[model samples]
Target: MPLASQPAGRRERNKQQKLDRITAAARELFAERGVDEVTTQEIADKADIGAGTLFLYAKTKGELLLLVQNSTYADALAQGKSEAASLADLLDAVMAILRPVVECNRKQIDNGRTYLREIIFGDPEEPHHRDAIGMTVQTEKAIAEVLQRDERVSADDAATLAHIVSAIMFVSMAATINIAKPVDEIVAEIKDQVRVLLPK
Candidate 1:
């Protein structure tokens, strides 16, 4: 019976190893040359896996980008949350939460824009897309928690303002006119909008 369980565990481990390889390959290729220039075949080759196996992990290039970006986004959010926790001012705390996220997105500008598009237009039923959406929700929740620190803000108002802040961040990141803008410029734009949204 233990031997039977051993085989299942091995299979699961193998699956995870393949997934890790796929993620690493995609991350490297996407970083070096934006997702638009990177091919699935190249990623599969880098991962030493077949194209079929690559599809088994992510059905499309967009999905592959999602798989790659989601991890970075999560790390950025975690950093933001930590930084926000220590700030006393509401605007500073909110910017602390948003700055890392904007930096993460703009690391590869085209890829960042593409990732945002995929998050808006990708198939929600897909696991990677779903995870991307979950990241947004988590980001909002983090901001809302920060908002609630103000005695005047109700829980519902905090949540609503957080949603608006998330929209401002995403729109600032995704807008085509801002494509050439520096990360700091984008962060500043978001900060300006978010500052207005916060209670006086």
Candidate 2:
């Protein structure tokens, strides 16, 4: 068989299993002790992997957060969209899709206070960062779909609205949650913005 035609299926499966173990370990440690307090060697020990091997997967401690939280962010997006479906009004729909993801980010907000932006928008070439960007695109697509349900909005307009909504969600969350301000008030303000931004 050619190199490309080889059944590296078992090898690929093993690789994914190792990655799962590492991510699981990272998640547990980060949650228990917080990200800043946990070390890579501790993670590797928990995963039963070598320290060097752990480094191969995540180059830095920050990347480890990305690796662990990537699936969580994706899950929050999925859950948010599902919750958004029952909401008829555009403001409710938009906020439904945003709240879970916002709460998830808030968990790490303490340690993430400094590099939250970098964590959200990571280097595209890296694995965890690429996953982060992919989830973001998924989120934007969900928002566009929500907007599309209303016949009043054109597809182009809905897409444009989704883009604006995405930025607003990020900025609002960052600004409001950064200073330990009220998320509820921020969400209310965002609701007003969406009301005016979208057409009836």
lDDT of each: 0.95, 0.80
C-alpha-based local distance difference test score of model 2: 0.80
RMSD of each: 2.4, 3.3
lDDT of 1 by residue, 1-200 (tens): 66666555787889999999999999999999889898999999999999999999999999999999999999999999999999999999999999999999999999999999999999999999999999999999999999999999999999999999999999999999999999989999999888889999
Compute the lDDT for candidate 1.
0.95
Candidate 2: misplaced stretches above 4 Å? 1-10, 111-115, 119-121
The TM-scores, one per candidate, come to 0.95, 0.84
lDDT tens digits by residue: candidate 2, 89-125 = 8778888998887777766664443235655666778
Candidate 1 clashing pairs, residues 3+ apart or interchain: none
User: What's model 1's lDDT at 48?
Assistant: 97
